[model samples]
Target: MSSDIAQPTTATGHARQYGDRALQTLLSANRALLRAEQVNALYQEMCRIIVETGGYAMAWIGIARHDPGRSVDAVAHYGDRDGYLRDLRISWADVANGRGPTGTAIRTESVQINHDFECNPRMEPWRERARSHGYRSSLSIPLRDERAVFGALTLYAREPDAFDGAELELLNQLAEDLSHGVRHLRLRQEHAHNARLLRRSLFATIEALTVALEKKDPFTAGHQRRVSRLSARIARELGVSDFDIEGIRIAAQLHDVGMIQVPSELLVKTGPLTPDDYDLIRRHARAGFDILEPIDFPWPVAEMVHQHHERIDGGGYPRGLRGERILLGARIIAVADTAVAMNTAKPYRETPGPDATLQALRDGRGTAYDPAVVDACLHLLRDLREAA
Candidate 1:
């Protein structure tokens, strides 16, 4: 170390020089913090504001690492660094290397200051570089939250004993503000991640339920899934919004869920159903609505299930909802359900080809089915044929 030592300086002189700039730094950072949406941008701009507005020689934010090594990594920096970090190593351990302002502030959870770089024994390793860079003083203020200290904001100045008691207190308040910012960003990221996980879980559970229904009725093994795919395709072709399309697809998958309550023998009877059996089968739509109403779905799923069998001409089962009174999701599921059912074999009728299904849709476009849905379904089917 050199012979130059920092004597007790006049508090009034240092306070007068930096008081105005310190207040401005705090105000500027608070403004930027209000609009910061990401972590990197928040710290990088913070470093810039501190060095440019606060009149500091250099400023950096160092975050502590505990797993691999007890080292402080300088994540964000502004102003002149001048190779100061190339030969410098600081830790929060109880050793000589951890005695510097940065390390001491982090370890002790308080402000650490080196009023003189050339003569201070704690800053001996940095004296030569500090002298060449015209830096005479350093301040390390801990970045803390409610629980513990996570890092430190290390700053340098050209004047000896530049940071007085008043300045240190102001800097501490700035560090606390940064801690709140970091906490806010972390909570937002965690919430978004959790939302994605919840959606995935809900989808897996619903798909499993649909599969179980398929196993119970072997003749309709993949009927619901096929109707779901077709319903989604028609909705997209009709220019339905993504949100409604998702609801339509989900509703189609579970539209026949009430069939589970029907007797298994009646499902594969291979003959026309008796009046009693027909009545039980007709009650399936209402039964499905009751079973699904208890669960809180994001969409109008239960209502769609209850309305899927209703006709637009007041000629269809359970409740004969006519015209535009039927829900859009229910309407889409109806078209897809009829098309797939006509194509597949059933106890009541033999399987018809795709052309026959199209003919049925053409004949009943406005009377039974919604005209727009029929048109969209036809368009999608025609495109697939042309592409093939």
Candidate 2:
């Protein structure tokens, strides 16, 4: 009889140890899942695990409004079909504001555990909705960063007393994991948004500068746009990656940004240029570099613009960089700018036809331009003519 009692006692101890190990494993997995910097991914994983573990019939996460006075927003929902989730946008006003479990949890910064929703006074109004959805009990755990409450993770179960002390503890751990993930994701998204805005502002400033330069030299009107279009075509023909092609297009559009600093009289003068005027013209590249050096850009757009006047044979100005030493984007823009200049009417020359322009490029191939880029430009023009 004593041996039987001892065996049962030992079995209970082992069972408790196994349960503790299982809880640790679950917490570790939750922590790992929450490290993802995507809010939707974190929410989906959390919901799937809770449903699989019989912790919930459905789950949802709501983010508090960015405005201090506004209602929270439902950002993530699980256990609902795609179409249903789309219509799950809820407002704090829709609930008895700060009355339901979720609202109460968020407002009080505590978990609202409804083991028996039918008898719970706090859940009285929400009881019918829960029952109609086949949820008899629910738990709402407040999600918080170090500073303050941000939202709540609400879990619904189909049976009463579904969440015991152990399950509530586990939910609390999951909530902490989720809060950290949410904070990280929000920060990343904000950074990306700010970057996009900064890039747009820089592009707008470049366009304004180009327009001002064009006004000073009416003969150069439409020059930057045409160069950008032609450069993009050449990049495509060369099978350059789309990212580099975009860089070339931007560089081409701003290639002559330094011309903004040149004297208007020097630009519009129809007479022959003095050596001093020529010198002023040569200074535009460095002027452009100086203007752009301070602005933060994702790529070396300023440097590419500065080098657009450079030649492959070590003959170009400002830096006189040679061959592959010049950025590929700068080389592509150089060919495009030269081609456009040769084919378009300028203050100093007549507009040559496309055939004459191609011949000139072929003649000056290695001396003034990158040979491979020139070949690509010729091929691009042929394709355009054929398409036309």
Top lDDT prediction, candidate number: 1
Q: At residue 360, what lDDT does model 2 achieve? A: 81
Off by over 4 Å in 1: 1-35, 48-57, 65-71, 78-83, 86-89, 129-134, 158-173, 322-325, 383-388
For residues 137-253, write the lDDT of model 2, one tens digit per residue.
777888898799888888776666555445557667778777877788888889989889887897798788778878878888888888899898888988899988887888788
Q: Candidate 1 residues 1-388, lDDT tens each?
A: 1122465375676686677777888899999889998977888898899999999999988888895458888888898657666656778876787877888888888788788886687678778888998998888888876678989888898887777666666777787898899888878878988878987886886787688777778888888888899999889988899998888888899999888888888788798878998999888899889988887778999899999988899888787889888998888888888888878888766887677888998898998899999898888776333211
lDDT of 1 at 118: 69
Candidate 2 Cα misplacement greater than 4 A, ranges: 1-49, 52-55, 62-100, 118-134, 383-388
lDDT of all the models against the reference? 0.82, 0.74
Tell me the TM-score of each prediction against the true structure. 0.79, 0.78
Winner by TM-score: 1
For candidate 1, the per-residue lDDT at 301 reads: 91
- lDDT for model 2 comes to 0.74
- Candidate 2 is scored at a TM of 0.78
